[model samples]
Target: MTDFITRFAPSPTGPLHLGHAYSAMLCHDMARTAQGRFLLRMEDTDLQRSKPEWDALIREDLTWLGLHWDAPVLRQSEQISSYDLYLDQLAEHDLLYPCSCSRADIRAALSAPQEGHPHEVYPGTCKARPISDRNQGDALRLHLDRALVMLADDLPSFQETGGTHKGTHQIDPDQAQEQIGDVVLTRKGERMIAYFLASAIDDATQGITHVIRGEDLFDFTAIQVILLTLLNLSVPTYHHHRLIRDENGKRLAKRDDARAISTYRNDGRTPSDIRRMVGL
Candidate 1:
């Protein structure tokens, strides 16, 4: 059996929240129970919005929660060049395209007799257009149509984290192909690369064997799976744990300061209390 490895990756966009606590604790506990190594990775890819103070706070919060890791956390903001190399690799394979469409244009152009994730379906006006012909836009999208055609003959199964299907739930590939089309690989105004690409590369290079995150991100799994295949990297097992929602059944956000881990910490709440609060 492969030695299990997991990581707690948090973006320092804002303070940690109840949802974050639940997810981090789950990763911490699972790695411990399985005798796996749990790593700490700071996802500060969004350079414009990410701050060192918040990064420091994230470290402080997780430690206060009684979670410690090996020295030298994997901070992604320091790894922009690596991301660019991967992009160059994809570009060499003719797998990426530049997208110049704006959000309003996408919404206006979409003729959706279709379903999608939280993001509205892209109209794909520039899907067939070449990158050179497109304007300098804020986001860059993966060429999904080309990607699927390439996978038509060799669609393969990627490993997901154990306990992913502890209940009755099913999803189909046909539905996946239809529902998700070309999505952003790099967004405008984002200093570094986007999450999907950064995540896949980091997980592969860091020797991560199990990728654990929230189930809300479950639908986006296909994008990363394709990334792993395109880059010839091993697909780590994915464990998308449940999220912490409030009475309204909405996932918690860092903006909700009342539930912010800093707020809780300031209120003299212990990490044990956080674990209990989020029912981890």
Candidate 2:
């Protein structure tokens, strides 16, 4: 069997837009071309927003696009306990701490600029909070300083096979510390793991060899790589393909129902039409 395993993981919180179709078709085509496996994963970890109807609709849209995945599709909602184990592993290293800061709090901190302080990144409002103080409703954030110190001599890096930044890139501690800061791993009281952490863990667990997704996520790859390296998991090659944007050049979001795959299909567009529209 080929080792070029990949996945098209999408949250079932909204309709499957054209952007989703492009990404799914790209992954499907790549795996088929390599005679490898293309898997489907429902990132339904957002318990509040995730719905069974949306999940069904997403699968239906993908199937209608003539795309197919292997048996036993994985769902993130069912893997919470497994993710909790990973979080515990990080906690064992003292890399995680409780964060009670809300988005508004973070925004206010960033807006009120302090000298030599990074504006866009988290200001470490709860960095001093110990893990032992973690309550039922507090979010968990990775202490990048300690995590980087743990891997001082061996910072994680990955090879990019696609996108404008095509090359072997290493994680720069300074950029990660200043720009990315201490990122939350779990939401407040939700028990929902962050996208980067869960996706990284899932990629390793599923034996994914290549991560094919939009270039918008390229910047966040380093943090994921760091997590994988910390857990001693295999890091996958990433291909951040160009996004399929609308006529106004805005990248498609779930709310863009007019550009949804189902809408196009309902308008009498065929699978070939989709491939052509996406320039595949």
Candidate 3:
């Protein structure tokens, strides 16, 4: 087998849809074709919404679609301690700060809608505030300005192989501030680890050489790249594929049961049908 390793990670919050199948199949086929390892990860960090049943359903759907993942699926819920360790390292470097801003607070602060991303680009509202003034319910946010300054001379670059955005890209100081602002590292909940934080750590630790995901996440790749650079971890090549959209040209959501793999299976759809639908 080659040294190339890839993963198909899905959150256990809903049924496996066509979009999820496409992503999983793409990752699986890539690894199989290159004689590399394909790993499965369950991103069940949302304690309130994640369910074991959904995890089981995901496995069944993947199996029904004739997909195979490496043994011993990794669950994000089991890696909180590891995430906390990295969080501590960032804190020691003074690149993290407490954020007590509520959703309403953020919405009120940003008068205009955030371009290219769904969530509002954080305005670094609580960055200058003292960490001692942090409340128990407060979440942690990355100080992008301070982080960039810390890595002033040693900023890292990443390679992309997918879509029109393919190339070696460097972190633009101006773009980082304007487009990707101070992102939250932790949230005010049981599972404090944010998606970017956990994903960066997992990709590095698991030795993932290539990251394959939808183009919708293209904008957020910079955030993960920054985190990996700060943590002194290896950055992998990225391949951002096209997303599966609905009739309205909207990306398929988890709640869209009509487009779900389970529904297709019930309607006598074969694995080949799935591959054909997703243009495999």
Clashing pairs in 3: none
What TM-score do all the candidates reach, one by one? 0.86, 0.93, 0.93
List the lowest-lDDT window of 10 residues for candidate 3: 106-115
Judge candidate 2 against the unseen true structure and give its global Cα lDDT, from 0 to 1.
0.85
- RMSD in Å for candidate 1, one decimal? 4.4
- In terms of lDDT, the best-performing candidate is 2
Q: Which stretches of model 1 miss by more than 4 angstroms?
A: 103-117, 132-138, 161-173, 187-191
- Each candidate: RMSD: 4.4, 4.4, 3.2
State the lDDT of candidate 2 residue by residue for 58-153, as single tens digits: 999999999999857899899887888888899999999988877554323312122234335778888999999988777888899999999999
- Cα lDDT computed for each candidate against the true fold: 0.73, 0.85, 0.82
- Stretches off by above 4 angstroms in model 3 are 103-117
TM-score: the better of candidates 1 and 3: 3
Instruction: Summarize candidate 3's per-residue lDDT along 111-156 as a digit string, tens digits.
Output: 1112234656787678897656667767778888998898789777
The model with the greater lDDT, 2 or 3, is 2
**Candidate 1 local accuracy as lDDT?**
0.73
